[model samples]
Target: MKFEVGDKVVIQHSNDEGEVVEIINDKMVLVDVRGVKFPAYTDQLDFPYFKRFTEKKLFPAEKKPKKYIDQLPPEKPAPGKKKERIAQLADGVWLTFLPVFDSDEFGDDVVESLKIYLVNNSTLAFNFSYTLTYSGNSDFNLDGALPSMQDFYLHDIPFANLNDNPVFGCDFSLMTPDRKLAEHYEASLKLRAKQVFGRIEEIRKKGEATFSFKLFDEYPLRPYEEEKPVDTLGLGKLAGSGFRIYEASNGAAAYGVGEERA
Candidate 1:
């Protein structure tokens, strides 16, 4: 029970080694284990000289070989080719919700949020405008061009937002270079809270990352129009009627009239 300052002692009933820093009384003394100091009874601590000598002789410490900078192993070269992104989505434009789970383990996983994506699975490029509304109020809006067979990340929606009745609307126009013009396709999706929960359950059961709804199977194209011959005469007659040609102005008005008729 005699513990003095600067004495290296082993705390009894444990392998903690500390140095006595102060003697509170004949029984309790302040001991510093590593950097932490605590009061301990003198009877609970003993000199570590015999224990240290016995351990050093019984279990000799193994010396590790010193590693030099020149002796270190060379780093391996990185791979030349990168992995390609691949997805086997159906041939349609899809609004996909990828659930981000709170836990990575299987079963009882909770969806933290959902990553929204506009997936263009068909062979058509489109300039798209997307909007998300909550409770009849616009919450998010994005505009971008989506390429064929690729997915565009819109934004993330918290899982709790499903209870507020969010509506996702998208308008798409073909990125065509031809003179033909088609009407912009508009699509909207609104899912109930129960429906979203059901989809989450289905995703968990199927071990899939995303639950998607098809927006459109095929992108609508402009109806084809038959080309007509240009009428060179101003006699108010059709070109196919074989009328005799007269003096006419071959300027912008002639081309404009032909285009308007076509």
Candidate 2:
């Protein structure tokens, strides 16, 4: 009756379905399917089957031109005097795709930001990824940084203004105030992060730290999006304690360590 990582479920009465994405807080599964991932409330999705596919079952459907989510109608790109889009890019059972070489300017900016966040938080030790929008340019391909940074920034939503719920997916904070600030930082990273970045810290870099966040009894992920592709966490059942952030991973059992499996 409960779903964990790797559960194949249809969307209630619909044929649309996917594997569980990462359990962001609790009672939610980040779902992955057809090369995209999203957050979904468990109750919203019905699971009538299990173990239908293996890690080996996953294979590239075919070769095609890599399209940017920005090109999609549902999503818009930054225009003149327009602010750039930046937010946390998450998919099911997060298997980090640290595409640092994904872009040129953004890639370097994120690396610089990560370093800054680490120093500000002072917890030390961190695991952050950048989104890389594939351009098919092998020579231009940072191989990793570009794409990763691209995706990371793509999901970089408004953290500064919490009154608007949240655009950024997840953020860690040693203290509530810090969490608020981190959330704000995420929101304003693209808008105004120079001064904000000056005052934060990272976990891994430090010996140890703890984090807390608002928990969700059930959260349905965004069903499809290329930039923030879906993931398959396969969380069969989750604890009410929600998710715990120790160091820099999802948790102790998450994907074997602080994160859901890919």
Per-model TM-score on C-alpha atoms: 0.51, 0.24
Model 2 RMSD in angstroms: 30.7
Per residue, candidate 1 scores C-alpha lDDT tens digits across 47-139 of 888677666756657999999999999999987731111224678999987666565466455777777888787878999999999999999
Where model 2 places Cα greater than 4 Å from the true spot, the runs are: 49-262
lDDT of each: 0.75, 0.34
Per-residue lDDT over 3-108 for candidate 2, one digit per residue giving the tens place of the 0 to 100 score: 7888787755345766775653344456675544544556666765542333235677788898888886774776753111121322211222111111245443
Candidate 1 structure, TM-score to reference = 0.51
| Best model per lDDT | 1
